[model samples]
Structure formats: C-alpha cells, structure tokens
Target: MERARFDNLPLEWIRAFEAAARTGSFTAAAQETGVTQSAISQRIDKLEKQLGTHLFLRQARSIALTVEGETWLPHVQTAFESLRQSSEGLFGAARSRLTISASSSIIDLWILPRLARLTEDIGAQLSLRTMVLAAGAAQEDDTIRIRYGAGDWPVAYKVPLYNEMIAPVAAPELLASASDWKELPRIALSGPRPGWNEWSARHGTPTTPLPALRFDTFVSALAAARAGHGVLLASLPLCAGDLAGGKLLRVCEESLSCHQSYWLLASNEAVSRRQWNRLETILKDPVPREGA
Candidate 1:
C-alpha cells in the first residue's frame, strides 16, 4: 500500500476542516475563525481532496459529519487543545520570571533600596535591566518597563507611575554658602528629561543659563550633590532617601511638574502572571515619609 500523502494537506485547511466538523456548520466555524463561510467551505473541500475522503454531508439548513470526519474530529480537536494548553503553561511559567527594565535613574534612586522587602517566593527570579529612553521604545520581550513619558502607547497596557516632579537639591553646605540661585553652578543629572528652565519659569527666576557639570548617572549626580558640588535638579523620588538622610536638601520649597510621568508597561505575555501581580504590589506601595 502507498504511504498516505501528507504534502497536499495544509495546516490551515486542516484547521478549517477541524473547526467546521466540530461546530457542525461551515457558517459557524467561519464566524469563530473570523473568515467567510465560503472560505471555510473551500478549505474543507481542499482537505477532502487531499485525503480523498468526504468529511461532511452538507444540507441546506445544517451539516452532519461523514464517517471520515467523525473519525478525524476527535484527534484534531485533542491535538489542538493539547497544543493550546501547553503553550499557555509555558507562557505562564516564563512570565513568572520577572525581568524589570527601566531608566537607570529610576533603578538607582527608587527601586534599589526597597527591593529587600518583597521576600515572597513566587517561582520567579526578579531581574533588572536598563535601556535608554531616548534610543527608542522597549522591545516586545521586555517584561516590566518603567519609562518617562506622557504614556500614549498603541496596543499595550500602560499605567502612570508618577509625575516627574523636580526641584533643585544640593548638599546642606552648598545651599548655605550660595549667595543666591543665580550664583550657583548648574549640575546635570544623567537622564533624557530636563528641568532647569521649567523650574526657572515656575519659580519666577531669570532664565540666565548657568554652566552645568555633567554627571553620567543620577547616582553620580546624587554623589556630587551630597558633596556640595553644585545645584542639581533632581526627581523627588530619586532624591527622597538623601533628603531624608539629611545628606541633601531641597534648594527651594517649590517644585515644577515636568508633565512627563513614569509609566509601568507589560507585554501581553507578562501581564497574566501572579509574579506581575506581586511586582505591581511592590510598586504601588507608598513612598515612606521624608523623615520616616
């Protein structure tokens, strides 16, 4: 006997054939699969040609499975169902291993100090990665991403984390010694967003540009601030610890909202996990009071 020819049988046609057989109507199957009834019929007809067997007995009002279809239906349905279940299982497991990617400033100033408290074992190892916001959007594989922006995204789940509120901060000695705001040297905290001009506008200070010492990272900027190097326009949360510790002081009470916010994003695959739930729980916790 000649071995059965599988070459003529297409996976798409098999899928269509399976759906039509399972639903007992071409019209119903087409609706489920988002295709036209005639398309489903054509697929089934092609499948039948490939197999040299009639799979359905068509009637004006309804359809009934022929002997061959009755035989093939269970196997096809079982295979597809098993594939779907396995895929879900694998995806769920992958999602549990959380890798959070964000701007370096956020990781250094906000997330690093607080991670020890999320001690629960959720069968996932938490990891952090940094990417440049100015470069482009997060890749499709990134699990949890915190970005600074207005949060307009297409085809994604996005949540506003915090507004980029900023104010001038410096070591206690630097503020005590500077004659006025105009006398201080400007300092650059490494990140894409800028706050100096915005601060000047909000505080009614003159827009005379000051020469800034550039630091490659927020942590470096914080270090310089702590050492009384210059005036640093820093994110509130990023400098929260230093301010609380008395290492750094806010230069002025007034702060300018940068209009950009930190947003939490997840790919569809990463959103469904219990680990993501736990991460969100950690993120949503209120920042401790300045002195607390």
Candidate 2:
C-alpha cells in the first residue's frame, strides 16, 4: 500500500494517533491535548486516509489497535521520543547544578530581577557568586561570568546581556521638584561606563555637572539617586527595573548609546549546548517589558 510522505504528514494527527493508541481511548487523547474527543477522532481518521490504512478497530464501547496500527505504533513512539530528546537537549536547561559569577552591582540591579525567569529558562538551580571587581569574574573555571566590555573574552561562548545605554536619570520626586536636573548634584561611580564628560560631548551639551557624592560602584550611586540626593548618569540596562517600576525617572528623553555591553561568558565545560542556547535566549532579552 502507498504511504503518505512523512514530510506531508501533520504532526498533530500523528500526536492524536499516538496518544489515542497509547492510552487506548480517544477521550484520554482529547484530555491530554485539551481538545474534544471528536477532534482527536477526526485527526486520526484523516491520518488513516492519508496513510491508506485503518489504525483502530472501533467497538460499541471501546477501541482496539488494528494489526497495521500495532505494527506502526512502536516506530511512531520512537520518533516521538527522539523529538522529545532533541528538543530537551537543544533548548531545555540541563538538570546539573549551575554556578554563575558577576559583579555585585550586576547581580543586584540586573540579574536579581530577571533571576526567577533565568533559572526557569535554563532548567537548573543557580549558585551565584558576586565578583568583587571586573577582574574577579574572569579568574575562574566551571563558572559562567557576566562581564562588561567590548566582548573580547577568549571563551567558548559569549553573548551580550543587552546594549548599554547611559543618560541622566533621577528619583521621580527629584525631577518633579522643578529643580534644574543639570544643576542638581550629580552622583558619580568608578567604572568603564561613560560619564558626564562623555555625555556632554556626545549630545552637544555644554556643561558636565560634577558629582557632589561619589561611590566606587553603581549600587551605591543608584541608591543615592533613588534617595533624591542627585542625578545619576546611569546604565539604562542595569536600572531598567527601577525606571519601569517608577523608582527612578529618565531626566531626558535621550540615551547615550555605548559600544560596550555586559556579556555572559563561559568556558567550554561551563555549559552544555542545550543550556547555552537557553541562556542566550533568556539573557539577550533580560529586561521585562512594561506591565509584564
């Protein structure tokens, strides 16, 4: 008997036939797929027509597999299992424990907010380590590192967290005070991130406000900004949550885009191909959308 070309066969029909065959009930197949029993019946009927063979022996109160169906069942089941394994291996996070290291500020401002979704996407529980400095996250093996740079790491895999954008941002209340944002005391931090001088130069602004308060890290600088002490030239990616949640407000509509970005870097042994693919999908769009 002629058979339908495999490529032409509808996967949904195959799924209906497989589920009905496995459970010995059309009702059960419908329950599994959230469709009506008649829908499953229609699919299998169409499937039989395409294959030119009956797959079930229908009875008054039940059904049994035909000889052809019994012969074809194991092959279909094997194909389903193979598809499952391929999907899980390529897109599902591994069940192994995962270790990740990044700066305290990235962990606090960026990673922490998206972490629940991150873990879910990778399909593993995470062991997080806060890197004390930029150099700290690099000096490790069997750990995935989040680093900010031009993506020059000599690692097996590296993907950017998001494009880094900087601009003046302040507490909503501070901006609402009707104070000149440029005249408000600025908050400064030590990092490779572009600051007031770069902002002034890039956007054709004349004045570069000096910081009245300074800190060595973004966590401190942002805290001061949130408290309404001053405006901060902030990393938009890092403070994305705050801006979305109304904890902070953009001082201007413009953003100073940067050439560098935070990166997820990992050595070969640090992740499976499946896990890495999952990580890329999750981290590339790390920030949650508004009202989400």
Q: List the lowest-lDDT window of 10 residues for candidate 2.
A: 283-292
Please give the lDDT score at residue 130 for candidate 1.
85
User: Per-candidate TM vs. native?
Assistant: 0.63, 0.64
For candidate 1, the 10 contiguous residues with the lowest summed lDDT are: 283-292
What lDDT is reached at residue 128 by model 2? 91
Q: Give candidate 1 regions above 4 Å deviation.
A: 1-36, 39-94, 119-122, 132-138, 190-192, 271-273, 288-292
| Deviation from native of the Cα of residue 196 in model 2, angstroms | 0.8
189-286: candidate 2 lDDT, tens digit per residue: 88898978788888887565677788888998999999999899999878887888899999889888899988999865777768877677766775
Please, what are the lDDT tens digits per residue for candidate 1 over residues 129-197? 886645555376556788777887652456766666788887878778866855777787555667566
The lDDT of model 1 is: 0.73
The number of residue pairs in model 1 that clash at the backbone is 0
In candidate 1, list every pair of residues with a backbone clash: none
Residue 81 in model 1: lDDT: 73
